[model samples]
Target chain A: MLYLIGMGLHDERDLSLKAVEALRGCERVYLESYTSCFNGDINRLQEMLGKEVVLLDRKDLEENPEENVLAGGEVGLIVMGDPMVATTHSDLVLRAREKGAEVKVIHSSSVYSAIAETGLQIYKFGRTTTIAYPEGDYFPKSPYEALKENHMRGLHTLLLLDVKADEGRYMTVNEGIKYLLMMEESCLQNQFKKDSKCVGVARLGGDTAIRYGTAEEVIKEEFGGPPHILIVPGKMHYMEEEMLKAYEV
Target chain B: MLYLIGMGLHDERDLSLKAVEALRGCERVYLESYTSCFNGDINRLQEMLGKEVVLLDRKDLEENPEENVLAGGEVGLIVMGDPMVATTHSDLVLRAREKGAEVKVIHSSSVYSAIAETGLQIYKFGRTTTIAYPEGDYFPKSPYEALKENHMRGLHTLLLLDVKADEGRYMTVNEGIKYLLMMEESCLQNQFKKDSKCVGVARLGGDTAIRYGTAEEVIKEEFGGPPHILIVPGKMHYMEEEMLKAYEV
Candidate 1:
């Protein structure tokens, strides 16, 4: 049996009681650390579950899932957010099942829904996009284009920042804003403006810090850490405006 | 301090360790029961947390939030799924804050992200809409229009089935499909086809059941009970197609 569990967001205590109970009965536990940023203390998690958790990189889970799945016992693969949110884990489920392993998924909190803490309407959100830290000339402008389309439709966009967890590199919201500005300069798309209001969220689910301001203000403001998300609101309802006031810097 | 905690999906054990610990210290715990359907045993939750959970309706939360907030002590308002996903809760947060109450949200798993378990790319979803149980002339066709727009944009739509939890009435997937088809007939829009493929998901996060098939097939197929959601997939990637096969009936 392979149990794909979600560690939710933030600390080990973010894990559900069901997850804790299941981890106690697992023979082997592996935490996939490359996908998302989870600053939780592994030793604390180990103490709570009474199980030894081995860390697995992107290659271990993506290229060589069989090595983990073929263990032939109750193996647990802990994902940072909801287990199947990443397509890689979904493929892992198929691979595990094909290898004659019974798979069970224990879902937990994900940044996708937790973004509502910013008081932005979830249903009003359009297709979510990610802003990656450009290496050399490998910058991508598709995220900017997607946000542009959502803006045109008067829908909000949740921009997820790239995280290279293995390298201890997490893209800050400030960097994400700068990337958008760079894209605007290159593409000459008049979508993003200096005074455009956006919301920057940091460390959600555990003592979160949220600030709502224009692109100029947000880019200059210090959000104070990783696991940051940017929300570009398109059209705001009066009620939404009222709720956002609580987070305005 | 007012703590808005999420119970996740399904049962009592689905509550996160953080939620449990917070509830233990809470002087008043009220479960908002009108928004979504949570078939979890309340007694079991009380037994586990050692706290008696009170039930709050839409009126208690919306019209008179002071009843839940003015306690001048730590109050926990337990919500099914992620605490702030519903705009009503966001309004509650604002109201609580206005009443000089400090607010902290404990996030949990939500159907918004859990639907990715069906192999649909979460980023490809656009503008989620809900299908309400038609009441007399109050039948709305906006959900169908939203799904049509998503289809045009080659984006998937997550149709949340409306639940009247207070009345003990939950909308089934079959009723949701029928509602869409009825909307199509009234609007004279050829937006939906009988042979169009759709995914019906039920009781996610606990004993989850998924079935993928054409609208004709899914509508005729019984998906057991309540708390069902429908997914209308757009252009599918080959990997998504392969992953969805596991759910195809």
Candidate 2:
């Protein structure tokens, strides 16, 4: 059976026993790295799983490189977070199904529910987006749009940053904050009032990570930790408001 | 230290090694029962973690039961899914801080990203709402409202079913579908377009779970699984459309 397992958020231990079982049984196991970042390096996971896992990167899956991985033997695609979280892996599942392979999913913890651990209200969040590394001509608009949309609706937007599998680079909270400010500045320049507030969360789902206040003035007091996300708080419920003050660091 | 650990999607093995470590050293570990319904009982978890864990129902935190577990040593709050996914453990965190106890969070996987693993676009998801078990006085409109809201905004809505902690009752996909249909019927009665499509997932992150197809169809299908969720699709991206057809059961 072809098993698609999720290696939860963070390290090797985030993988469930069922996921571990998938690793042990699969004759060929592949890890996909495009959707989300695995905080612990791949080598460590390889060592922990005691198998040299073949990587099914963005290119490999799109290109269908080595079709034998899914075609031959009991192959498993191991995705960081959850395999189906991104639309790209869904393409792979489609391709695998076309090849007449028996495909199954062994789910793992995803960042979606993990955010609540940061003391944020799950109900308050609106649309979620990722802030990509600024390219020369192409600015990251999704994060800005998502934040704007959330603010307009009085909801919180969780901004996920870019993860480079090839370069091993994770976007920092400071950088994400800077991007938001840049977006706000542009909006102000366009005669729009930029009264939206934000909260920066660093190293989510990890011990010793920081979950502190909102906005540029407040976030200045926070850390420049990598593996971070910025939250734009919208309309807050009484309990949610109480939580913000109560959990304020 | 007050350690909040996520029990992941399943049983003890779903927990990260860090969570196990925290559970081992804690003076008292309270597994919050209000939010989670485990596939495996607490006894198995207690034996696996090698500690006597106490199930802290809602009354312990909400109503004053006059029993304190946080006073002795390091107190462990174990949660199913991720630590803060369902309930705001932050209130407890604030309370602990008021008592001058140091609080630490050990993260686990949540169901949020698992929907993406099912080939749905994560960005398109709007505010999430949970469907409650049918009550005589309650013709609940929350889950339907969330779904309609997402549809209006051209986004998807994740539907989480209610879990009764004390009774060990979990609302299944079948029941959840019925709830949605009830809402859809109301929408139809109100002259609203009730043609909104939904995707029901059974046993998210488990070994044997169904991940795709409409809730109505899924309700008819045999799903002898553990945990389940439904993703009511909104406006689909090109890739998302491809994935739906590709991964649809």
Q: What's model 1's lDDT at B56?
A: 84
TM-score of each: 0.98, 0.87
Query: After superposition, which runs of candidate 1 have C-alpha atoms over 4 Å from their true positions?
Result: none
lDDT, candidate 2, A130-231, per-residue tens: 888888988866676767666766677788878876777777766777777777676653211233455666655554354445554545555544566666
For model 2, the superposed segments whose C-alpha errors exceed 4 Å read: A41-44, A54-57, A189-196, A218-225, A246-249, B64-68, B184-195, B207-219, B246-249
* Candidate 1, pairs of clashing residues: none
TM-score of chain A of each: 0.97, 0.86
Q: Relative to the unseen true structure, what is the C-alpha lDDT of residue A57 in candidate 1, on a scale of 0 to 100?
A: 94
RMSD of 2: 3.3
Clashing pairs in 2: A84-B116, A84-B117, A85-B116, A85-B117, A107-B205, A109-B109, A110-B110, A154-A234, A154-A235, A155-A234
iRMS per model in Å: 0.7, 2.1
C-alpha root-mean-square deviation, candidate 1: 1.2
